[model samples]
Target: NDKLKFTIRGSYINNLTSKNSRVNLNTGVTWFAGKGWTVNFLNTSSFHRVTNNTGSSSFTSSYFELGINKSFDIQQPRHKYYNYTAVFYKDLNGNRIHDANEPGVSDVLAEIIRANPEQDLKDKNYNGEFLSNELYSNDKGKIEYDNIVEGVYNIKYIPKDIQNAHYESEGTEKQFVAKKDTVMYIPFMERNKLFGKISLHRTQHSALGDIPLGNIKITVEGNDKTYSALTDKEGYFEMYIPVSDYYKVKINNIFREHFTLRQESYIIKFNGYKRFELSFDFDEKARKIHFDESDFLITDEEENGNVSFEDIKVIKQTNLRGIVKDANSLLPIHAIVSIFNNKTGELISETASSRRTGVYFTSFFAGDSYTIKVKAQGYWTYTEDLYLNQITTFDNVNRDILLRKTYIDEEIKTENLRFKSGNSELSALAKAELDNLVSTLFLNPDIIIEIGGHTDDMEALSVNAKQLSEMRAKAVADYMKQRGLSEKRMKIRALSNHDPKSRLDTPEGRAQNRRVSIIIAGF
Candidate 1:
């Protein structure tokens, strides 16, 4: 109950009255047993709030009282049954036994669940995870479930802090019963698990040596979810992913407009190991992709959980097109056009020209120089170096290669051999081209051959031009001799500037003039 009063004097500052409110609830129960045994239970609650002009205050209180009367003739039912006990001991050897230094594990929460035999198998908790009817264990590291109604029962234990504790059931659910009292010895497993780290490096084969690729974005897709990670500056990455044997891996550099590899979809298999160390390998379909090394080492700390992918750069690819035509007829010819990195000579992509139109399509990144190698069945090989600058609004490159027929004494121009700048040292591509020449000479062993090296008129000094031309031709002959050919079977001729392939009028014509040719000499 509360009362309030107010008085007005001047305009606004007179007097203000205070008010209070009170609420209460009470309930009682009397459980009576025959002959005088009775128990009385009382519950009461009250709340009061007082308010002035400034603020208010509230107080709440509750009371419960239970009374029992003792003298009574009522008898308690007694059940004759033994107690079910649980004894927990540490198996230092993980064999579920309490050996010499091993002692009983104390204060572990071991709950008990009991269900009737005829109950439907669908009798599950709201989460449909566990069965109903549970009991907790005592602090003595022992659980005693007594007078267990003649039904099936199961004991379950889960680790509290997995860092220090862990457990596993011995496949005995729904089978343990208490027709008579029984004691159960549950097994526990230590939480120590085999952990490891992974290192990612991308190795590339180049004319100089092997190169490592970095800033690669990788994803390991599992059954439930996918894990993303980025390699470091040294092309290293590690993560703590769930156990999975087969993971769908998708790796690319699409964000920076770099099409390093056209094939990114891989069904990778992670072999089972307590501490697994491994790397990835891409087959014929993996072009311009580097597989440096996948290294593995074991550790107890799980640090891969915090691995982030903030630094890896991805890129998009642009569409590139061209056609292949014959030099004499200028007509379309079916040929294979392959792209490689101009700087590293790493093969990137390969496509064939259509049979009817000789049209071809491919994908490449912008702002990079690429070398295209075209090969047809009856024609000599051709290679061209080109540069594409547009990245935003990319335009198709219409490079039509003119391939010459390969016949006896025709001196058809093939891919120019790559040599070390200002030196006669042959590059990988140069060696590959010489291999084809050696095969041709071996097939026609009954005949002799002459290799001629030519130069454009660009070299100002005639002596320097003649020297470079002769050195290049001698390099080719030396390679053929190493391939089991006699020195007498091959002859080298240095023909500089005099017999240019075309007029040294433009850069393209000059490029055609700087070459080496294989001539068929008499037997």
Candidate 2:
């Protein structure tokens, strides 16, 4: 074996005045002496000249140096010739170093250590008695050492007045006790089994690919213990982890996106090994969508017996029935029916369809006013107020709902009316109806309706007809006027003692005779 020595040198110069010529020179030498003490020499020079004869000048400079070096012996003698190399840039003029300062800069720091500090011995000096080395950086922040042994070493740098350096070294070659066999014991009580599969498909055809992604890291976190595994080429991953009260798995893709799945925190009590599988699909355009435990088939014990099929069949058989139809045509019409509590406004049931024959049959409790709102996509929603007191007996209630198709051309009809007996005064219910009429009229100013009054056969023909008809007609006109209906479009007429639609023989028939009507005379 020989003691090897090497030297490097360099220089540069720039001429700022006239012609501005620059020159640089570098040279080095190496020597090997059989006795270990190797000596070497180096030199560098620079010269600059102004080509303009008006004020021409030239300057030159050179450096000379010598050094001696030797090797160290340690128990791990294989590292005797080991060395490290580093390059750094000085913040000269607030910028890093350049070629001009090479071979002359001195004292920059360089540190090398076994990445696994537990296995490598620690030391404070350059005795070479142990597993690491630290060398000062040069003025130009560059240093080199050669012949280091094969091992993973972390390199750190301490820049003058800058932050401390950090790095990571990887690979099994850095492990000491290479010939020692190590075993890890996983007790049955502490083991957990997790199974999952990932699928990658084409965005356009949804075609699956056989190409699998191996080395995908899956981490399970439980009881502060993190278990990691690499997926197989088929995108399947399974591993036994330490049983913890709570657990979650994190999947990280090669593209840097991550997905996490959480599990309930409870002891799994089973006769055999507990296993679960998670399946998911991946789209190139949409990335990955993780499927949770609910997406997989799993079983749990129920302390109480499960409900029987026969019981469920009986429950479904007793539901109420209903049919929805168009009011004007008596034809079935598809509609969305949402049953809500009239007082609370909470929904009790809902159904929808798009065909002409819309039928809904659902259950409900008695003694509540239920509001059924029916809406077809493009049609106005129709609401009906119904009191369920009629079905308190628990018998099946058959309801036939007639939904009027909302027409853009049709205005509200106001023919239904009831008046106080033998008086011109309007009833409270009539006043409310008249308010609605007023709103309709304001919405469509072109609409016109004739208000007509009639009476039943009573008193003398002339007096009974005149008083009954005039009072009824004037009562309706007064109500419309109070509700902001324009007098120009509303026409009041009293056919009092003249027209009689019913006889006065019975109270029901007589009540129907005292009424007012609104006819759509023109639009």
Candidate 3:
């Protein structure tokens, strides 16, 4: 092609007529890179030698040359070129960190303006017109501008040009020195508003209309943060939230004392909407009494059903209360009832059931997880997990506990409670038996028992039978106590080799003797 060319030239000279010799060599290549541009490389070598009486000495030297040449007209002005790219993304979190879930916003119009007016005028004079100053972002939220003159510039955007009106840029504009290729990352945050209303149904199964639940508190929990708002007298509330896939909306526990909701919480998902409206209904716990329309001011009016208030029984009082009874006899019993925080195990409330009526009373704050423990002298500790979301419900306030008595001197098959040879660790079979034993001990809080360890008669097979026996017994006692049985109720005894359940003449007999036995000591 005429646009490019390559060439090489060389010259060599040598003289051999005299004792002293001289040589010269020259090589070079020239390339036509592009329009009015050329690249060249040239090398030269020289050699000289002199003959003397003692020895001959020679001198050699080489020269290399490399350069780029361009032909230009003096009338044309020199201009340096630069490239720029801009990327836009939604800033879900205001932290300025680009998270994986945040997506790009496309088709946004951006304007490039030179910061220096002199440079701007020069660019316009040289380029004729700056038509590439304004462009829209591509589908990938990127805008690429090439062949821009080297200068300081600013990239600006119009708020209305963005895809959503609720979005606002993180910065007023981007300022960069376009000395080389550069990229700008711009982030925008979404300001979404949600409006909500909370109402209460006056009567069950009837729409005498709904009354606005004033002063009710609502909370939105997500992103490891929480936002709260209160309803006005008209049951209207508004809150602004960050962009997220899901947020849990729940009524504050303070408002739960007077109302109950069938669905305790709601999930809100932002789907690129500027505004949202939501409504929730709650069952009011207010007492119903006989009253005429003239007796009080009613806020709502609807004709869903009509019933006589005289037939409705008014509840005088209500409490967080329950009854304790025997599981088998179904008779009222006296026991200690306690509530503990399920997470921290801290005691929150403690009370005793009446000896005569078997009724216990205690109160708790709503929206907390707790462990309800009921214990008696000879009954297994009864435990139930409770989450008090709404305190005004009938079942929420009424919790009954049934106590089952512990097993007394129950025969546990001893053959299944043997340990491995030369090991004090309880086997799976032994652990299973000990679990049953622990349950008995848990309910029989007043009972004291002894754990006895025995071994077969094998003096040559064992180094220290008594020590191994003691360890086996202690292992069983330790396991039971760890499972909620009191350590004070257990006593360990090592009865090695002297009391074997079977003859040690056989391996099966030895296995039977290597066992731990539970003995009832006192109650």
lDDT of 2 by residue, 1-523 (tens): 2444445554455545545776767666657664555567776767766667577777887777676666533435443344445555432221223345323324445566666555444533224434566787665455665555545565665434332322111111212222222211111122446778766655552212222355566777765556687777677888764434556666764322222223212233223445656654554554344656653433353215443444332211113456777777777777777778878878977755325345555544443577777665334456677654552234465667776554433434653576546666777777878887776556456667777887766533435677668778877877788778878887778876455557657767766777887765565
What C-alpha lDDT do the candidate models reach, one value each? 0.59, 0.55, 0.71
Ranking by lDDT: 3, 1, 2
User: Which of the two candidates, 1 or 2, achieves a greater lDDT against the reference?
Assistant: 1
Give the 10-residue window scoring lowest on summed lDDT in candidate 3: 205-214
lDDT of 3 by residue, 64-174 (tens): 999899986233255666778887877876566667777777767889887766756665455533343788777777889987776678888755364445666645678
The model with the greatest lDDT is 3
Q: Which candidate ranks first by TM-score, i.e. highest?
A: 3
TM-score versus the correct structure, for each prediction: 0.26, 0.25, 0.31
Better of 2 and 3 by lDDT: 3
> How should the candidates be ordered by TM-score, best one leading?
3, 1, 2
Per-residue lDDT tens digits of candidate 1, residues 279-310? 44332222364433532232335255433354
RMSD of each: 29.8, 27.0, 21.7
